[model samples]
Target: MKDKTNEISMKKKIKNKAFSLMAKKGLKDISMREIAEACGVTKPVLYYYFKDKEDLCYSLIVEKSVVSNENLKKFAASGASFEEILVFIFSEYMQDISHKDVFPFVIHVSSYLLSNPDLGKRFEVVKEQNFAVISGILEKEYKKGTITKKGKEMALQLIFANLAHLILNSCEHAIKFSPSYPKDMARAILKAIDYREK
Candidate 1:
């Protein structure tokens, strides 16, 4: 039992350390040696846990994305109304982007991967899986006549477009050293949801 607990704890520590370093240093600048130093371990140990930097980064991104998707799905599963679902998603996204230091890096890496044919495929797969979670909720809302789109394709596009715009705006503000205005932006997103609002 103690051994299992120690193993779990050590794994968490390594993940946390790697994520911190990735956030501060960016993917291109981060090295296994740096992650090891941050974790108070050595490069060989990191390699033992992860094959390479790309492997570590891919794992981290997928892990975080899946976890976020799970939480969003749980919120959607709560028998909430469409408006409530929209608000919940916006609030949760704002909270995640603002608080998690690694998210900015994750977004950056995703964008980069999406442009390269080799890595783009993997990121795209991960993206589709994550998007399906939100799209599924949107599909339910659309079926209930709560949203404009009646199909998953349209719903997915709109959701992704809105979310991508909001995230990019927030990132730009952060880069400028300006205070985050997620609530204001989130409200704008809420207002833009349907033809009636337009």
Candidate 2:
């Protein structure tokens, strides 16, 4: 039991350090040795857990994305109104990101992922599965006519696209926009989906 706990703790430590390093150094440019040092572990220790750098990255992506998806599921089940849910998701997700710089780092990693089909597909599958969870909720709302006339496609597109934009704007773009932008955007997104204000 202690060993398992240590394993989980070590993985989390490595992930946090690697993510911070990647955010600053760019994912492709970071070396496994550097990641080891960042985690206070030897290169051989890293190798014992991760087959290679790509494998470690794949695990990171899978683990983080899964957590995001699970959070979405919990929010969906929380019985909050769609608008309330959107506000909470956007506000909380953006605020909870340990480092804003990781957004740009993610974009860099995504470009590399495309060239690696095996990892890319696994990544896509995780994304699609997560989206499906949101999609199911939207479908229910659409049937109830609680959402705007734009329907499922537009709602889904707007919700996720706006999320990406928020992250990028906050991270990559130099402009220091209003702190309220995320919540404001969230409200607007909901309004775009349904004209009737909740």
Candidate 3:
């Protein structure tokens, strides 16, 4: 019994290592042998966990997309107003940058994979779920007369589009710009979302 559990745990560790490597070098340059080495294992051990490179990439994509959508949903469920919700979402990104280098690549990889129909479908589903959560929050705020907009679905899309742009922009200059990049991006995103803020 314990042996099976240990094997499963070891497999998970290898899979996570592969995802981390993919985030660093990207899918185009990643190899099974490299992934195994990164995980301190042999190429055959990596193959024991995954069929091939494509299988590893797909698994990572599905895991990441699902986890991200879940987090977004939980954040949107907070009783915060539209502006507060926007701030919370942006602030979460600000907080994650230091601890997890792969954080920024989450959206970047999803956008890059938009060209692949299979991956695009998964991305679209996760995106729709995220937007639905945001739209629900916006609808609540609108009902409370905080947001003067009736078209919440459009508003949610715009907010997410702005977020994606902010992430992309910050990532482009994050290394050279140092801490200023994410800070500036957060401010810009907040300003875009809270146009009526006094």
| lDDT, candidate 2, 108-182, per-residue tens | 788778777777776787778768977887887877777644666787888788767666666645555566866
User: Between 2 and 3, whose TM-score is larger?
Assistant: 2
Error of 2 at 25 (Å): 2.3
The CA lDDT at 83 in model 2 is: 73
Q: How do the residues 1-198 of candidate 1 rate in per-residue lDDT, one tens digit apiece? A: 998898778777988887877777777778888888888988887887899887888887788788888887888788765555666666666666675573577665765576667976766778888777877876666666655763445546655776676567666455432233344443454456542321
RMSD of 3: 4.5
| Model 3 residue 98 CA deviation in Å | 4.2
Model 3: per-residue Cα lDDT over 1-198, one tens digit each:
998998889878887887777778766667888988888888887888789876776676567657766776676675544555666666665554444545545654665576566756755665676666677777676676544674455566666675665555556455443445445544564455454442
Which consecutive 10 residues in model 1 have the weakest lDDT in total?
176-185
TM-score of each: 0.78, 0.84, 0.66
Candidate 3 has an lDDT of 0.64
Please report the candidate that would top TM-score against the real structure: 2
Clashing pairs in 2: 148-193, 148-194
Give the Cα-based TM-score of candidate 3 against the true structure.
0.66
Sorted on lDDT, best first, the list reads 2, 1, 3
Error of 3 at 75 (Å): 4.2
Residue runs of model 2 more than 4 Å from their true location after superposition? 148-150, 177-179, 195-198
Model 1, CA-based lDDT:
0.69
Error of 1 at 12 (Å): 1.7
For each candidate in the order shown, give its overall lDDT on alpha carbons. Answer: 0.69, 0.76, 0.64
Clash pairs (backbone) in predicted model 3 = none
